[model samples]
Target chain A: MLIDWFTVVAQAINFLILVWLLKRFLYQPILDAIDAREQRIAQTLAEADAKKAAARLERDEFERKNRELDEQRQSMVSRMQDEVSGLRQKLLDDAQSAAERLQTKWHVNLQRQQQRLGEGISRRVQDEVFSITRKTILDLADDDLEASIINVFIGRLRQLDGEALANFVQALTAAEAAVRIRSAFELTDEQQTAIRQVLREIFPADAAVRFDCEPELIAGIELTAGGRRVAWSIEDYLKTLKDSLGDLVREQDSSQGTPTAESESLA
Target chain B: MQLSPDEQVFWQYGFIKLNATIVYTWGLMLVMALGSRFITRQLSTEHTRSRWQNLLEIIVTGIVKQMKEVGLSEPQRYLGFLGTLFLFIAVASLFTIFPGYQPPTGSLSTTAALALCVLVAVPLFGIQEQGVAGYLGSYIKPTILMLPFNLMSEVSRTLALAIRLFGNMMSGAMIVGILLAITPFVFPVVMTLLGLLTGMVQAYIFSILAAVYIAAATQGHQANPDLATNAPKAHSQTNGISHG
Candidate 1:
């Protein structure tokens, strides 16, 4: 009695119509809008992530390049320092070599100068001794030394053996052959006659004789026939004195442990 | 005074009688249609919205959320059918605050029709979700001998849903009418307020029970998804009839 069939059918139809209307107007549009907004948000997040990744990559690359540049700069600076150090060492070696060569040359020059001074002093001493010997002999002779020397020579001619007398006569055989005599002093007439008598004994009586005075011989007599001649002088005694003096100087130098140094020739 | 909307027949043409139930149902439908049309005329997808549009959005969203909380994984799929059912019942109950207003849900015929709609929709949704063979396969579940009992259960549950709403609404109205007769002053007003609260509760209960049956028909979906998904705002049971 409570149920009405017509009303039930009517209400079901009305409910169905309502369902259709709300479906078309309400649910569809709102769901679509929400989905669209969610999709937009997802897209924005994805873009931001990509940009962040790219920026991180760029920053890493730049830092790597900067590190490489810094390393290269350090390497270059080290190389330059090494080069400069090497150059300094080389310059020092060259300077040391040059200084050693200059020292050797300067030492050689000093040696040469010392040797020259020694030679000059030795020559002056030798000349002074020679002059003193000549003056002493001249004062002691009182102008008789030349006559005594002639007389001694004449006597030595008389005592000669046959072979020696024959050699003296053989040298006088040239057509223009002559005898020349030199002495440290002038000869007198008596001394010349005696020298001529001694020569007559060995050569023809017409043989010419020439006489000359040479002070370099010190005090000595000299003889000549063609290119043959004989002489005597005080210079022989002076040479013996010089040899004895040189031996004394060498012995003193050796005892004192002095290194041998070159000396210029007194000659 | 008429005990039911069915007995308050305004136009009777032989076996076919036009009653207060049909008229009021039509009037409620018209009001719903016109209001929706005006509110949805110029909808905007921008941030700003008209007040009516905002109200409609709240209602539609609330219904969709409720349907999802019930069991529908895709709430929008069931929003139209379920939302209309809820709106119709709630509107019928709510308009009672006005003088001389009678709710269509108080009529046994209207409540039966609503239950019939659920009964029809259950198999249709079941067949759509699962094939005809699969849907029919649910009857023989637990044992092959349970097929007749399952069929009986389906018919019995539909009848129960219709009768429950009718009994609750009609009893409230009857109690208020009786109280009006006895005291006729402040007691009737207090009973009317209590009746409104009961009507709203009944509307919510009827729709949720219908959703449970539909969820049962669908199978593989939870009848109350709040348990499975751990949703916080779960609907508490007024009566435990929805356990099926």
Candidate 2:
């Protein structure tokens, strides 16, 4: 009584149709959408992972290059330091050598200046000594200084002995011309006879004698025969005094260790 | 008052009469179909979606999960038959809050039709999973003498499924109707609320029982041994509820 066969059949068909309708409109589309969204999310995640890996690689490469650059800069700085040190040492050596050369040149110039000063002092001493000695000799003696000088020269000739006596005797004997006598002043006839008699007594019997006047002897007398002469003059004594003063200046310079201005000029 | 929607005839041509049961069933069907079509018209595959689409997906997936729990390997394959059963029954019961709305499920004809559909679907799905011979051989399981008992069990369980749903839905509607006459205001509203709760439970029980039968038919009961044992226990309990 509760069941209606016609209605049951109709409801069963209706339910079946609803099943088909829901499956088409609802389940299928919803399932597909979910699947699509999941796939899109997965793809995005994969791409993000790839980009992360690439970024890591790039960072590593950049760090490697930075390390290499630091090493290169360090080496360059060390090399530059080494070159600077070497250059500094070379400059120092060049400066030292230049200073030594300048000192040596200065020493040479100092030595040349000293030599010129010594030559000038020597010349002045010679002129002053010669003039003073001639004046003193003429003023101190009451007789003519030229006659006194002549007598002193004759006395030196008479005192000759040994080799000097032999050489003088041989020169007078071997004369090709007459033995000649010269004096700073003119001789009177009596004085010339006296000198000729002395020469005749010392020479061979065939030897001849002559007399002449010369003034360059500076208050002295000379006898000449066969290119040999016996003479005395104030010029010889002046030369001996100049040599003694030069030896005193050298000894003083050595004791002092360094050259004073006077000692350097003298040297 | 009519005890069932079947007695309320809208049109008749002898044995072929259009009744309240058929007319209300069509209305429910049309509403369900149109609602699904309208919501799914511009379904977005994007992250943001319509709230209705969300609601629908939740419902469909929930049904799928329940079927899966029943040991159905691929729940989507049986989704059309099983999901519609729950939706149709629940929707019919839910419309009871409206004045003068007669739920089609309160009629024995509609419940029987749903149960018959489950009966036919069980064999169809079993035959689809295993050949006809393999499916038929299951009746003679354990011995040849058990074949008659197995066939009787199948028919009885299908009868049980139909009558259980019909009794729960009809009793709730009938109790609300009888209470509305006696108390009129407060008691009938409370009973109606209670009827709604009972209707939802019956809808769940009916659909779940249908799924269990399908699972057993397809030989998937072995997959989840717990479900296998629990399903029959629930059947016996619900059978007690229906008898009372």
Off by over 4 Å in 2: A54-267, B142-145, B219-227, B233-244
DockQ, every prediction: 0.40, 0.64
Q: Give the per-residue lDDT digits (tens) of candidate 2, residues A1-267.
A: 999999999999989998998889878877777677778778878899999899999999999999999999999999999999999999988987787667666666766566556657766776677778767754654346656676676677667767876777776666666777887667767667766766665554556767778755556678887777877866566667888867765655455435544543453
The sequence of per-residue lDDT tens digits that candidate 1 reaches over residues A1-267 is 788899899888878987777667666655555555557667778888898899899999999999999999999999999999999998888887777666556656765565555556666777788677777886776466766766665666667678765676677775367788887778888788888887786665568888898867766777877666555567767998888766765555454333422222110
Instruction: Return the top candidate by lDDT.
Output: 2
TM-score of every candidate relative to the true structure: 0.61, 0.70
Candidate 2 pairs with clashing backbones: none
Which residue pairs in candidate 1 have backbone atoms (N, alpha carbon, C) closer than 3 angstroms, thus clashing?
A220-A232
List runs of model 1 lying over 4 Å from the truth: A1-4, A87-267, B1-76, B86-107, B166-204, B220-238, B241-244
lDDT of 2 at B184: 90
Show what share of the native A-B interface contacts model 1 retains.
0.58
Q: How do the candidates score on chain B by TM-score?
A: 0.88, 0.94
lDDT of 2 at B38: 93
RMSD of each: 8.8, 6.9
